[model samples]
Target chain A: MKLTDAKAQFISSWGAFGTHWGINRTMAQIHALLLISPDPITQDDIMEQLSISRGNVNMNTRDLIDWGLVERVLIPGERKEFFTAEKDIWKVATQIIKERKKRELDPMLKLLSQLEQIEGDKKDKDVKQFVDTIAGIRKFGGQADKVLDVMIKADENWFLGSLLKFFK
Target chain B: MKLTDAKAQFISSWGAFGTHWGINRTMAQIHALLLISPDPITQDDIMEQLSISRGNVNMNTRDLIDWGLVERVLIPGERKEFFTAEKDIWKVATQIIKERKKRELDPMLKLLSQLEQIEGDKKDKDVKQFVDTIAGIRKFGGQADKVLDVMIKADENWFLGSLLKFFK
Candidate 1:
């Protein structure tokens, strides 16, 4: 495929994939564009390239920055702000993992723990099932929490190599 | 909290959580309801409990079955179909991982590989960055695919035990 066509395909696909994972299409497309760009780009550039509005470019870029996947940079001689994505995919993955664990997993685990303490007799089958399911999820989430913690802290090469070797 | 209230809270929260991960709210709510129920429930029961329409329950239940998280069971002499969720949290996690990898990750990795072959000079910065980004994502997705395969086929106790130990 032609370079421009290939680029558009990648951006569109990435946006769709992102929506499946609960990220908005525009934000993901912006991220994809930044990922493949060789240099930082301005909001106007992003809006023009993606055919999105200025307000859209402004908001999604802020969200991306909050997610630690993108950053704002000052141009050497220009007054406009430029944005760039972290090009290292490993860092990108780990950063997302860290943020999600903080946002979702930690709170869910805490709630599960509280729910397990619901007043009930062990002999009641309904109570037993509820407790058992909640406990099982809590345990599994705890294990995942620990695993993700290690992964976030470990170097990508070391972690990936070890995991691949272990699985093989 | 009262048992019924607590159950309601759990179901509501789980549905909200599912939305963040791209699962629909109703589907997640139904799954959560099934997860905690001691007995298999029928379509009418789900509708009454969730305050949803029959059509909504029917569609979401079908999707839940499709995802392998819920199953239809025949009661000893009952005329209606009953549904139950796989309450073993490990099984639930593995099943989801298996299905998502098949649906999303596999296709994405395949596309990335094809994108890597875009005609371009390796020395061009944009070309180099695009190729590198695609390669990195493909490699990561491939590793995840392998790891998920191992997890899916593994016995729950053995897999979690090994992973916890490895992380420790």
Candidate 2:
């Protein structure tokens, strides 16, 4: 419960959780440090707290900013850039979902669409079989996308109210 | 958009995403394959479809079963385990969250608690400072855990209702 012990433990656990969510360990740890600080924290302070090298800190900070989960803070008289995490956990989760869909989901959708145009499958049994196989996957992927879209855009109370519908 | 091109692209993108997700490449590809199949697929079929070694197919299939994302469905009168994915995307997401929390969150919580109990300076300035820093992190981690607990309880309607409230 002591302050110093608390800081180290926070950094360590945040780092471990990062890998599970497809993030680098150190990146999440730095975010953890920023989350609890009452005021903006400078890069120099971060380096000292986490005991990481300058380059590693710089790269991961950039990544966190890119993910829209952390932001730079400007102190009126301060020269060094300070950082803080996005405080609303729900918003943080939303930003992550949107970004991942844009980066990962959209591309897969485009690829699946393009595959539907392939020809020559009727001329060869093997080619036909391969095409059939891919068509199936494309169908599944599209369905999955629709499911994500539906979950995201469905009316308020959709998740709880429709639980029985899905079960049936 | 040729079927050939589409299949190739799907395999590659899915595999890349899997690496980020800690599922590795071949394992994800195999999962992708099974997800779309109209018929029950055997281990030999998986190996051929994935173009992976028999051992790779054997290992990843076991992993899929372990994760509860994929199941070894038995044929009516056959010996080989026919594989299939849990096609419900909601169920898929839930399983992933549960397994990941077990692998990443639970262990980190224990570690953080252990690190928090480490004794430090009661009177020394630096000792007091260090301990306070770690404590701040532990508090943040606890807050994060609270958010995740609510998320674990969420279903479709719960997600939508919460998002609507938060959005407004």
Candidate 3:
């Protein structure tokens, strides 16, 4: 495949993948474009390349920055803001994991804790089942929380090496 | 909280959580309902409880079954088919991991492999960056594939015990 064709394919596929994971398609495509670029790009460049509106680019870029996966880059004597994505895939993965843990898992765990305290007789089948389910989910979420904490803090070499060894 | 109110809250939250992760709200709500039910429930029961149409219940239940998180249960003398979710939270988690790995992660890795073969001069900065990004993602995806494989096959006690020790 030619480089340009390959790049287009990657961007398109990443967008589709993002939709499956609850992210907007245009946002993922912009991220994909930035990921493969050798230099930081302006919003105008992104708009032209992705064929998206300026407002769309503006919104998605802000979200990407919020996720800590992309950053604003300043160019000397340049009026327009430029953006760049973190190129290291490991760091990218860790950043996503960290944010999702905070946004989704932590909240779910809190809800489970509250649900576990529902007033009911333990002998009732409905009560027993509810408590058991909540407790099980809470325990699993707690374990995942700890595991992700370690991962977000560890460097690539130590984390992957230890994981490879342990899993092996 | 009363048992009914607690159940309502759990169902609502689970549905909301599912939307964040790209699962449909109705499907997750049905799964949540089945998870906490001590006995198998019929499609009509699900429709009445969740205030959804019969078609919606049928469609989402089929999807849940496809994901291996829920199953059809036949009562000996009943004419209607009943459904039940895999109530073991550990098993539910592993099943989802397994299905997503097969559906999404595996295909992504395959695409990355092909993208890695894009023809380009290595000295060109764009080509170099593209190749590097693809290669980095492939390596990380490969590692995750292996880890998820083990997790899918592992029993809960052993897997969680090992992960806790390893991460600690």
State the lDDT at B107 in candidate 1: 87
Report the candidate with higher TM-score, 1 versus 2: 1
Residues B62-141, candidate 3: write the lDDT tens digits: 99999999999999999999999998777788889999899999999999999999897999999999999999888888
Ranking by lDDT: 3, 1, 2
Number of the candidate with higher TM-score, 2 or 3: 3
CA lDDT, every model vs. true structure? 0.90, 0.70, 0.91
Full candidate order by DockQ, most accurate first: 3, 1, 2
Q: List the residue pairs that clash in candidate 3.
A: none
Q: For residues A1-168, could you state the per-residue lDDT of candidate 3 as single tens digits?
A: 999899999999999999888788998999999999999999999999999899999999999999999999999999999999999887898899989898999999999999999998999999999999888888888988987987777665676657645422
Two-chain DockQ for each candidate model: 0.58, 0.21, 0.61
Single out the weakest 10-residue window by summed lDDT for candidate 2 chain A: A159-168
Better of 1 and 2 by lDDT: 1
Residue runs of model 2 more than 4 Å from their true location after superposition: A116-168, B73-82, B87-94, B97-168
Q: What TM-score does structure 1 among the candidates reach?
A: 0.94
Interface CA RMSD of each prediction in angstroms: 3.0, 8.2, 3.1
